[model samples]
Target: MLRALSLALATALTVLPEAAFAAELDGRSLSALWALPFAGILLSIALFPLLAAHTWEHHQGKIAALWGLLVLIPMGLIAGPEAALHALAHTAFLEYIPFILLLLALFTVAGGVVVRGNLHGSPVTNTVLLAIGTGLASFIGTTGASMVMIRPVLRANDDRRHNAHVFVFFIFLVSNIGGSLTPLGDPPLFLGFLRGVDFFWTTQHLWPETLFVGGLVLAVFFLLDSIIYRKEGHIRPDPTPDQPVRVTGGINFLLIAVIIGAILMSATVDLGNITLLGIEIERANALRDLIMVAVTFTSLALTPKEHRLENGFSWGPIQEVAKLFAGIFIAIIPVLAMLKAGAEGPFAPLVALVSNPDGSANNAAYFWLTGGLSSFLDNAPTYLVFFELAGGDPQKLMTTGALSLAAISAGAVFMGANSYIGNAPNFMVYAIARDGGVKMPSFFGYMLWSGAVLIPTFLIATFLFFRA
Candidate 1:
């Protein structure tokens, strides 16, 4: 598989037209139909597992790749082979590779650190565990934090009769909203950092909103879990039985630190640019990806096999994520280009939604539009779109347009909880929990969960923090 992929990359690089270097793809000329492949891939992700679980399980990667080709073939016909290959190669090299590497590193490292044992799943215990995971997210990342924490929380509640709600709230706080504080917390925030937003800008400005929204969600989780607990009455005998929790594979934590350090170094240092074909990427960012790949292997090599086995770890979740998001990254190339084109593009009306009649910024529109796209599309790129729309000036945004920036940041990070595919970690968590016998909700069923809990939370947050 690795050799085949490497060969494909080589072929694309070798054949990329020199003419592709002469000009950029013009989004203003592209039709909205260009988005169909992307939308089709999303619908596949949403409907496949629900409608055709067995077939989807076997052929998801193929389905995703087909959607990718559906985009590329037409793109080659419409815009020339150079443009198509450029989009494919560029998205694969710069966007998908780096994005997947980070998720893979976090998932691998977190999986190696096994928390061995169980505790009774009381409302208080679950709440505290969720709180700790929430705090850890901004530092280790939502993916890292989710992988590390989900098992222990699941084990803590495995004995309870009615416990799916626990993981639902887990997704709410730990996977999404918890990632609002720092660039280290989520992909979108990290993108903002790379775009010149201060590493701590979100930390400073978003803390109050993160605090209020996270606190309210935490409170709601506690209350709902309490009610469920009261009704169920905790009568079920402990299945795993409570045991003394002993953490193994402590060395993986050091790898995690290395991961964090590499990311920071990439952001802080300038190591010049490396251009492959017509695409340019930072040497520091490439080095950061190399470090992440190394950390993934280092954790795997050092961690005991028993630790992973005991942790119930498998490669299925991350594999599925990588395949699905490859298609997403490819398919979304045109969609993002159109968005970047602003008023001259087909999405001009959608673009106008973020501005007032007087031509001032609309904070609420920024929040909802960014959040709404983020809920379906990947939040990282959605964040970049709105960030650029809101003037793309980090300094100005941090000051005069602070509220707009805050809304965009909050929306991108927070509303990712709106769907299973909103963030990388959400699907991974769902897969892990489901494999662990939690009877995790289906994709739309999970949306029902988010629509009930998260929508209201976001509504109140808009009223408080993002009002125009």
Candidate 2:
């Protein structure tokens, strides 16, 4: 069954040209189909909450439903139901939004059930754990390592009422910035790989920037924590903590491993062959989707209820994510539409401005602008756009040296810590923290934190790594 689906998807992709029929709406030719979806996402973010208030009394669920509607209904309306059906027909199931939601759900379950530790440890211990978590983020994937370690990190700092900002900064560093080293660290980098960038290329050129930023963040975090620790005074360690550290249900880790493996296999596997009974069906992505689905369901089914109860797993975080992100995705559609209509117009000016300057100036401008926009927009696509603009082709640029690519990659990955919306995992970390009972900063409020904390550090990074 999966093989058949794979073949169908492969046929569709092969048949469809990368530059398909260009839609001209409102006197502009639509070059990128993704623009509408982006606009719908942004609009849905604002409208979903209001729509939810009227449709369902439960604010969170309303948000989720509104998000679903925003993403689904617009295509039906604009292109007609047939267009919507066509989209679904061509859309690879592996890339669908629901798959991410399922991963979140599975991680929530596993963290809640199988993982246990003292939610009340020393501030120093908490900071160290956070550093470890952040460092691990780049290795195992920001989301994967984050889900595995966030609960314990939260528990370690539960005693400090005044140190919520500590974890917020931690998220900025570990969950977002720390993932710059390798493709496995972030989805955007993985997409870059699929597009033909070498797998080890990032670490080779970008590792210096990563080390520079990571070291600075660690130093700053230590100083900040030390000062806060002194002011708060000390509380004796808990003697018989409510949730003692224990790893009783270890099988859940296997489930997480399966999900990660599925992601990797899906990304790397070729589905051009392996037909059964002589049906030449090529669905590489479909096979990956099936694997993810199977692992997610199995994880949910096998997780013990007692473990969930202990970990305080609830539907709230996913509900909130669904609601806001849906709107964000919808609202950005028109903007994307505009960009697509004039593919060169929106980004071309920036490229021209950068190219006219010397190498250092071009690199710095690229870093700051890309980093700044990445705060709100999806950094992955933004990275791709600037990356393409930086040099026409990576292979052709042997003479330009690798410094330019290094700068672009660093800006996209490291500066993503600039805002909560900068990366996917940023918000997830926020949600997990809030769920763990630490009230995080609001949308714009987080920006203020980044401005005060990250901007200066980034400046230093630019000078040492890119400028020097």
* Candidate 1 lDDT (Cα, 0 to 1): 0.82
- lDDT (10s digit) by residue, model 1, range 1-468: 534543443344433333422255556666666677777887787677668989999999998997787767655654567877777778777767877788788778877877778877889999999999999899778987897789899888887888888888898899999999987789888767766788778999999999999999999999999998899964667778768988788898788789878977887999999988678989998999999899999989999988878767789878987898888777777677667677877778877898898988889999999999889777876787788678767889999999999999999999999988788788878888888889888778889988888899889999998886
Worst 10 residues of 1 by lDDT: 13-22
TM-score of each: 0.86, 0.70
After superposing candidate 2 on the true structure, give the runs of residues whose Cα lies further than 4 Å from its correct spot: 1-40, 43-113, 119-123, 198-201, 234-244, 263-269, 273-282, 315-347, 357-361, 384-409, 424-445
- In the range 278-305, model 2's lDDT, one tens digit per residue, is 3333476456656656765666677777
Candidate 2 lDDT at 438 equals 84
What's the true lDDT of residue 203 in model 1?
A: 91
Clashing pairs in 1: none
RMSD of model 1, in Å?
Answer: 5.1
